[model samples]
Target: MLLGTPAAPADAAESSLFRGTRQFPETALWNDSADPAELVRSIGFGAVGATCNPVIAYTAISKHLDEWAPRIARIAAENPTWGESQIGWRAVEELSIQAAKLLEPAFQASGGRNGRLSVQTDPRLHRDADALVEQAVRFSLLAENIIVKIPATAVGIRAIEEATYRGVSINVTVSFTVPQAVQAAEAIERGLDRRAADGLPEREFGSVVTIMGGRLDDWLKQVASTQRLLIEPGYLDWAGVAALKRAYAIFQERGYRARVLSAAFRNGLQWSELLGGDLVVSPPFDWQLRINENELPVVRRIDVPVDERIIAELSKISDFCRAYEPDGMTVEEFDDFGATRATLRQFLDADAQLDALVRDILIPAP
Candidate 1:
């Protein structure tokens, strides 16, 4: 298999030699009701997933607001046991289902390895652990290759446990810190263990740690300009080598089922530039396009062969998202409407324990 080959056709299987770039346009997957299959086919992306939040949902649903009025009215007439929330869920459900359907053939061809749709669980349920589990179960029923997008919240961990028990595949989304990542690995093992004990099928489960490349760099730059930017001096958890080293060591240790999914990837000495990576999830539209055209120029696999000393340093830091729970919080007490950014902010400010973990336990494995 040559390194450079023409992009595979829509109905074709993902190329063995070429790793597919997953694209999230920093916006909606489709606009003005763009045809899902046609758009996916045209993009040449081997797999594409939709990450919806309050904003994206509104953006996608807004286009059909007037158009859906008739549909809404019909639904209202047929089943009065509904509100705007129900309508919205149904609409998103249909869209997600259709998108999954479009990729159904490819998913089958790959034996569920690729060609799938990742629909995010409600952001409103980010903290409600039980709600997340319920949501995962519900969404799982909607599609076979569905990857229930769960936030890396404490509650999300519980959701992962429950959902995995129910035989649903989950993507631990928004994993920024090491402890959060370690906990994700722990949760995955626990889930896998439970599945094994229950005599459930051992499906290919994955725990991906999302290292926000540019976001972390940007945040670091912002913090570096501050006074207590003192998280520096001692160990290296924030920068290029330090971060990648931490990722590699853990992925190689405690969690074989857990893989490092380089996310929110920035351009610097990140994966493509200096540090060679085994796998990366692509989001930048322009770069992926350039990559497709062979226009990016230098796309070498960056493998930073670090020595044991570097490994020891990374083993020290504990985790990311100090405000979040190590095991994650249960999302049962909160309602969907009550889950807000302000609450997330509060948890973050309060979770000083986790911050210490990142600085202590989660840096790297010695």
Candidate 2:
């Protein structure tokens, strides 16, 4: 007797249902991975692009050094006098180019709207505007679809403006507040205007202000724990989502062209609440699978208000208050914000790790 074929998994059916609805028509799905295999998988799942940083690049390189060893060896040979950092930078650039080629089909299909790959400039140079600009321009040359990832620091803002003026697209990461997002968009517009004045086409370039969602909640949760504040279960979790919604509202009001990308999502709830806007939701591959498995509610929770008592309690902490404000922050304020400094430290740590890896590869055991 012949056996009947197995039925489709529940998660697959659920994913198909979500995909069919197209609830978030304006929002594009992007993969937040550095591995080319993972990038290909995301594309099959309808992700249009991928984001990369030193951490992701380091992980990818560490896992696939054999595949990359030939190019690394060649670069070392070609530039015998170059240091370890230079070699490491070249490795990341090459890996990013390979990932960009993989997503080129989506880039072409959207006619430059999607299929972009982001490669971040060195975090060590984040404080030096001129150096950041030089690095960003160099990374952009890796591919036409490459989006140079710049930190949202004061100096980073300047570098972003300069890079945009030079006709390079950007993805401003580590943005934590509405003010930071607005400032970054204004900087991009200024650069685009300068380009237009110089007779260059402005519409072809794109920019994104990546607001890290889950990290905000994590920060708030830690604060509450230290202060012995008894907060409602889900109240703190909504902090990031509320901030992003507020940022999107400001973007619309200003008619800014830069897209708002919600990243670092902690759970499916964050994804569900922030759906159906002109946003790009980029969670890790596992989070995407979680989002697809669950059936989303008919109505989203974008407009739900967090408790004022909770806000007031959080406002007692300076950083929390600054982050929760709907109005954008000043450049000076951005420098002092707790989240901004934390983000910079995180990037630097990742960069240091990449550097160590490069040194290990260059210097053999005695």
Candidate 3:
């Protein structure tokens, strides 16, 4: 049966693209939601895990604080000396803890492979290695299956290495290129080596390098017109896919321990190209609903080469070129790349927004 072809009634269960994708060792859904009900719904749809970020946490508390009132009240009561930011951080972590509990069964069943929930440390700490490590340690203590999400910045990479040394599972986010992905994986390996040297057991680390695909395409589209780059109708949105394909190739070549997570997908095509790869696709909840309703032919393109002409054209733009090269850029270059910088800035903005919301919650003016 072709990937996009509809399955017959008798074969529906067996031929479901989502279900079939899950059968692959690499394919698992990390539902990107902080709402418990949404998370439970994702679980019902066979999501193996979930992820929470500052934006999601802010939305949850701003819109559903009543649902989490008891937990928030407990946290507030326990730390009377704490301020709004502290309370906000705890509130976000609490949401993740609750979601992690829902996923704990899968974690046990998968032997640490699935059933994990990720909680991102403060984005403001992205450049502070020591702070990131301290926060990550505390977050890991919340649950055995909880994965600490760290930004894939130079300092964040250092934090990831240290966290790995401490046996904390990490999910490195905002990785948009092959160089960033390679660096993140190398950092994890160094941490594992350090752990082994210290006589610590080489525990099975559950980590992921998240490559933001849709955002890359969005960024490229904005610059394509200015650069006068010839982007074919078919290739306009393929930059992210091409970048991901290259990153996946390097991951396999080096046998990196962390899985590559294809995130921020714009459409079903992106999902189709990346199916059956040794990676996780953390599609938004809405995308999951769309995938369930549509008949999608499964297409695996990890092995397929990105068009040489397109690569050559993109190479004219240094930033785009750098993204496609594995380890071609230094740590500083990777951190300062236009897309990387913009993503980090956006994350900090989200954190600030969350901080404002927390202030309203804790220090409401009369």
Cα lDDT computed for each candidate against the true fold: 0.49, 0.76, 0.78
Q: Write the per-residue lDDT of candidate 2 for residues 1-366, one digit (tens) a residue.
A: 001112543224435224523556567778887689777766666688889877778888888878876777788889999887888888888889989999888788877778899999888887799998998888888898999888888888888899999878899987777778888898999999899899987465657888887877777788778888777667777777777887888887888888888887786656766666777778787676656556545344455555577666566555566776755467667766666777778877877877777666677557
- Give the per-residue lDDT digits (tens) of candidate 1, residues 324-366: 2233233322222122233344333423322332223223356
- Model 1, which residues run further than 4 Å from truth? 1-43, 48-55, 62-81, 226-245, 265-280, 284-287, 290-294, 297-302, 305-366
RMSD of every candidate to native, in Å, equals 11.9, 3.9, 3.7
Worst 10 residues of 2 by lDDT: 1-10
- Candidate 3 structure quality by residue, lDDT tens digits, 106-181: 8998889778999998988877899999999999999999998998888988899999999899998878888888
| Among all candidates shown, the one with the greatest TM-score | 3
Reference-based TM-score, model 1: 0.64
Backbone clashes per model, in order? 25, 2, 4
Error of 2 at 286 (Å): 2.2
Q: What is the lDDT of candidate 2?
A: 0.76
lDDT of 1 at 165: 79
Candidate 2 regions off by >4 Å? 1-21, 294-316
